[model samples]
Target: MDIRVKFLGGAKSVTGSKYLITVNDFHVLIDCGLFQGLKQLRLRNWDDLPVNPEKIDCIVLTHAHIDHSGYIPLLYKNGFGGKVHCTEPTLELADILLTDSAKLQEEEAEFANRKGYSKHNPAKPLYTVRDAIEALNILEAHPFDLTFRIHNQIEVRFFHAGHILGAASIELIIYSSQGIKRMVFSGDLGPMHNPLHFAPVKPPNADVLFMESTYGARRHKDVDLEKELRQLILESDKKGGCILIPAFSVGRTQLVLYYIWKIFQNMKSRPVYIDSPMAISVTHLYKSFSNYHRLESDSEFGHHIFDAPFVHYVTEQSKSKVLNTIKDRAIIISASGMATGGRVLHHLFHRLPREQDIVLFTGFLPEGTRGRDIANGEKLVKIFGEEVMINAKIHVLDGFSAHADQDELVEWSGHISEPPKMTFLIHGEKEQAEVLRERLIGRGWNVTIPDYLETFTLFDHV
Candidate 1:
């Protein structure tokens, strides 16, 4: 028996997380994420995988985030027909995210074709809504901490990862002739002190580990989250302009809403508009899964923390467009946290030119994304095929990021009683991963920062 691993994606990059584990003839994929951010990375989504889709026996997802689970539909469309397993909440959230991703692609393709701005003769989406729906049918949900079998030689279990509703750290128990080998995959870890979700659960001892390094090089700003948010709100109000926050629909949107509601209780509050239908749906899920998060059952507002009276859920496209008419004193939250795509682009197209408006990014922005360009003080950004001036005051509140920072990541890794024989730093930019690699090496752990398409032999002649 032999065991090997391949990094199809999410090795040196922060997005598109796919890892293939091969034990003899059986192959299991850890994640099937789509490449995001830069044009170079996005183009990888269109390329054929080095391994055939049908050759993959099963898929085990860590969470439902687009970058971790977005490529399922494309793989399924290509010929892969196997169960995609995840926790119950992850299964539900994946359904929502994947469907939304498909709709956005289809809408963008059609709009590009109509406007004749796309280089492709007639722009086409990577996968259709139909494909996403078909892929979803194969999803099987499991409970956290419960071990389940995918193959005769392989068993899997999940632990709470604390980033989002159904996020998890995966542990694979492989039975080989040499002995039982344990492997752990750290899905994106959340901050230890997050108010929305519990702290990440530590993994059991492992022989091999794959860890995320999204914030490995930097520590999050040590500011009072509520105080800073209130200050920003007050400042934006004084300027008499709306605060446009580009946040992820799942985790960041809900956290922003919770804080806004808490702060608005005593102050003169602005009309808070949640402009993404997907976000609204996800907010409701937070209400449904009480066991998954740290939110109180009943808030000052009412039974649901997300049910503040000042909040407006805009589901209609016409209503979303109408938000552009409001020049001042409103708080609008939209999706595609990095401003890579989605309705947030339309919101930015209108608000970026307004000097009084505030564009607040609630989390990390990947390199080559529009959010990064705007946050880096790039004066002009191309949106909807036209260059838009960026006069709006931009602020990045890393305190709102769900990903654990450098110290917290080290603290999480410290929980392991015995060091793994090998650890691979993944899901981060090159610099961030390198920083983490050095930090771990200093602790006397064997660490490697794998490159894209890199493969390793974990066990041979077992």
Candidate 2:
């Protein structure tokens, strides 16, 4: 029997995570995610998978982040009808993200066609909201730590990865004619000191390991993120200008809101508003899965994570548009963290020219993104075909990132009982992966920085 693994998407880049694992007569895909950032990478979303999706038996999602689980709907649309195994919170959050993704694609396509900016005669969405719902229906929810059988020859388990609400590291025990071998897939591992979720759990013994290196190249700077946020709010208020936060609706948005609610629960001047409908819905999901969070869901502080004296949720387009007209010193949090797309762009267009306002980023902004460009001090940016001056103060609060840093990743890897036979680093850019490869090598572990569509045989031939 031959057992092989393929690095589909998240090999040399930080986005679009898809891993295909093939065992004798059975095929399993892990982490069907969409690519973001550069136009070339984003274009890969429209490209067909290396293998036919119809032939795949099942998909195992690591988390609910768009880069880790966003491509499932597209896979389903391509004829994959098998079960998508994930934690309950992951399943629920996937529903929110995938649905929102489909809607966003449709909206972008419609806008492109109307504006005649697209090369195609009529721009088309990759998938529809109906397709997203179809994919969401097939998710099979499982709990962490419990071993379950996905096939007669394959057993699997989920460990807390701590990146998001239900992020997990997957352990697969594959039975072959030679013997049983374990393969561990570390999804996006969160920081050890994450305020919202617990640290990533240690992996059990394994023969092969696939790990993420999103922050492999550098250590996160020591900064008081909450304090910075509070200070920014106060400064913006003092200047009578709004503070705009472009956050990923899933983990970052919720975390930012949690910190805001905690820091300014008693403050009356900083009126906070969640302007993205998708983020508002995702925030509600955090309440539903109270046990998944580190804090007590029902406690006075915990129960009000999303509540502030003047906090508002702008669910309708009309209400969101009204925010652009308000010159008050309010805090607005919107989605599409990198400012790739979404209501956040509208806010950026309206507020970027205002010298007193501040544009704050609470998460990673990949290269080539508008957020990165502005963060890098680009003076002029095109929003809706109009050049907008970046007069607003650009601030990056790196302490809010969810991914584990270099030292923390090394610490996590040290938890393995023994060094695995081999480790393949994925989910990071080239320099980051190479830097981590060198670090892991120093610790006496063999590591490979895989390329996109690379393949490796996991089992020895007889």
Candidate 3:
């Protein structure tokens, strides 16, 4: 018997997570995510999978983030027919995200064609909404902690990773020729104290461990979240200027809303508008899956916290456009957290030049994104082929991040009952992964930092 794993993506980068595991003749792909940020990385989305999509037996999704689960639609569009197993909340959010992804693809293609900026004769979307719906049809939702068999020789269990509402860490056990082997994949561990979600579950003992190193080299700054938020809100309110926050629709958006509800419940507050339709829909799911969050009762707090009077949902495009025309003091939260694409870009185009306005970021911005450029104090940024001056006061609230920090990740990895024979550090930049490798080696753990497309034999016997 022989078993091996290959890194199709997410080796020394923060996006495009894909791993292929082969057990003799059987195959399973885990976390079929889309590449984002840099053009070189994003172009990989159009490249054919290392293995034929049709040959794959199943897809074990980690979560619903674009970088973790975005490529499912494209896979379906090509040729893949198998079960996509995930948490119930992931299924719901994926339905929304994939559809939105398809829409954005089509919109981007159309914009390129109209502006004659694309190299292609006629820009075409990689996949359509129909493809996304087709992908959504194959999703099979499972409850956490239930051991389910994907094939006669393989079994998997989903444990809470706490990065988002339905995020999970996967435990896989395979019966191979050498013997039974255990492998664990830390999908994306959450911080120790998330406001809306629970802390990540400690990983069970395994022969092989695949861990994420997204924040391996850095720790998030400890700041008074409410105080910073209050200061920004009051300053913006005083100037009669709007505060625009570019947040991820799934986890970060809801966290910001929760914080605002807590901070401004008694004081006179500005009307808060959720400008992304997908976020509006996802917030309702947060209520539906109250068991996954830190809330006591879904029914009691759902209306009070999420559906508050001050919170407004802008679902229509015309209504979203109207937000740009407004000059009053309000809090507008939009999507594509990194300002890569979405309504947030348009908000940035409108509000970035306003000295009194504020643009707040509550998430991590990858190195090549416009969000990072602005965060790094780039005075001039490009948006939609137009140069946009960055005059708006820029601020970041790292406390709202979904990924665990370096110390938190080390602490989470310490929970394994016994040290694994081999542990792979993945899902980060090369520098970040190396820093973590050194830290883990100092702790007497055997760690390997794999390169892109590298393969390793996990179990072998003759």
In terms of TM-score, which candidate is strongest?
1
Best by lDDT: 1
After superposing candidate 3 on the true structure, give the runs of residues whose Cα lies further than 4 Å from its correct spot. Answer: 298-303
For model 1, the stretches where C-alpha displacement exceeds 4 angstroms are 299-303
Candidate ranking (lDDT, best to worst): 1, 3, 2
Relative to the unseen true structure, what is the Cα RMSD of model 1?
1.1
lDDT of model 3, residue 129:
87
Q: How well is each residue in 213-288 modelled by candidate 2, as lDDT tens digits? A: 9999989999887788888888888778888999988878888877887777556546788989888887888788
Clashing pairs in 1: none
Sort every candidate by TM-score, greatest first.
1, 3, 2
For candidate 2, the lDDT comes to 0.88
The per-model lDDT (C-alpha) reads 0.92, 0.88, 0.90
lDDT score, candidate 2, position 360: 93
* Per-residue lDDT of candidate 3, residues 157-209 (tens digit): 99999999899999999875556789999999899898788999888889999
